[model samples]
Target: MKSSRIGRIPIPLNNVHVNAGDPFQVTGPLGVLTLTVPSVIKIKLYQTMIKVTPVFSNQRASAIQGTVRTLISNMVAGVTVGFRKVLVLNGVGFRVSIRNNILTLSLGYSHPIIYCVNRNIKLHLISPSELEVFGVDKQLVGQTSADIKRFHPIEPYKGKGIRFINETVNLKERTKKK
Candidate 1:
């Protein structure tokens, strides 16, 4: 058995309905999500309670069961509270703006970079140096943040580039002349 798979995920304070061998449905404050678990895993659901277990004693089955449970729990939390990613632009003239659903980035480059926003995601310009990305799907939010960061990744030398709000860049020291 996978020792790391014995953890239990807490269900959010919302309505959850589970049907054996079928997809589980969760309705929360943000939205609703459905998750389908494998037949090798067994799920028990009661009023405001959910427990997932592996049918077999195999380690793979236990790991899969834990993964499925965590995924479902995250989905429920995401739909209820949503997800947000913040990005900061660090450069002399690096800035970002959103107009008509398009994100225009000027990363101290010769030409501006324009990115078309997906309908499911919402982008907000908190300031010229700050951006806020919001979406119900965690993958979409993370992907969008990565895509934006790619335009100008944080440089270790000058640390001048786009980076996540919580990201920390290790700046390198300048070498002395021999």
Candidate 2:
């Protein structure tokens, strides 16, 4: 038996709606999401309890059932609580600004780079060197961060460029002449 397959997810007061046929609709401060379960899966939502089970004998079916339930639970939590990613610019003249949905970045380049923000994501410039990204979708958030980092990847020599707050750059050692 897969111990991780069995679990309980809490429903936030603002982001969960129970419906028939194991289908549910969840809305939160971030956004809204909907999920449907097949007959082979069983789901029960109490005042604050959510139970998921598989009717089939196959382990794959059980795993799928558990996965679907966990996804739905995460959606509820994400919509209610939202998610955030922070990026720090580490170099001279590396700065960012947002205007009319366009992010203008000056990462020690001769010309400024402009990136159009997607509708599903929110970008904020906390300062010239600090950027904050928010979105309900984790993948989108990560992609945006990567794209930004690509414009000016952190170099090993001086560790100059854009990078995540938690990221560490491996600096290369300078070789001495023989």
Candidate 3:
């Protein structure tokens, strides 16, 4: 059986404590995250490192091993350092504001869009066009960003919409007529 490349990577725990059991729990200063370990993967916790290995030498076992390792790694990182996502709006009359746990967005539409912020996630407005999302869970942070971006996705013609800070939109040229 071919060994898993990602499974071989050792995840070093800084100040986080990992409890290995049916449902693995990782606790740190920021927060605690729990994940269910696959039956085919064996999780071992040490003083300063966590190791994941496959119980059986099979293709499916190897795949689960790698996936479990990554999930555990993200849990550890999330609890320790947390996660953040930034979004920027580009367009005339485009703006974002947060007040009283409610996020209000004006994307050049007839009516304003309001989104209720999740208790686990923190939302901040850096500027009228920039917004930031913070959370201990990577999935939560990413999901919140995607939900907000879906309101006004980037248009191919004008490149006007909400997008991630690192995202780039390739604008299509306008049609020419004789």
Choose the strongest candidate by lDDT.
Answer: 3
Candidate 1 has its poorest 10 consecutive residues by lDDT at 3-12
- After superposition on all C-alphas, the RMSD of every candidate to the true structure, in Å, is 2.4, 2.9, 1.1
**Candidate 3 colliding pairs:** none
Query: Which ten residues in a row are the worst by lDDT in model 3?
Result: 15-24
- Write the candidate numbers in order of decreasing TM-score: 3, 1, 2
Per residue, candidate 1 scores C-alpha lDDT tens digits across 1-178 of 5523443564544643444445676766666667777887777766776777778878788788778777777776677778999999999999898988799999988999999988778998889999999977787889999999999989899999999999889999999999
Q: Residue-wise lDDT of candidate 3 within 1-178, one digit each (tens)?
A: 9758999799999988778876889999988888988788888778889989998999999998888888888888998889999999999999998998799999999999999989889888888899999988888899999999999999999899999999988889999998
Instruction: State every prediction's TM-score relative to the real structure.
Output: 0.86, 0.80, 0.95
Pitting candidate 2 against candidate 3, the one with the higher lDDT is: 3
**Which structure among the candidates has the greatest TM-score?**
3
Error of 3 at 90 (Å): 0.9
For residues 1-178, what per-residue lDDT tens digits would candidate 2 score against the true structure?
4423443344335445555353566666778666777776776667765677667667676777768677766776768776689999999888899988789999877899999978888998888899998987666788988898899888989999999989888999988899
> How badly does each model clash, as a count of residue pairs?
0, 0, 0
Arranged by lDDT with the best first, the candidates are 3, 1, 2
Q: Which candidate would rank higher by TM-score, 1 or 3?
A: 3
Error of 1 at 174 (Å): 1.5
Global lDDT of each model?
0.80, 0.76, 0.90
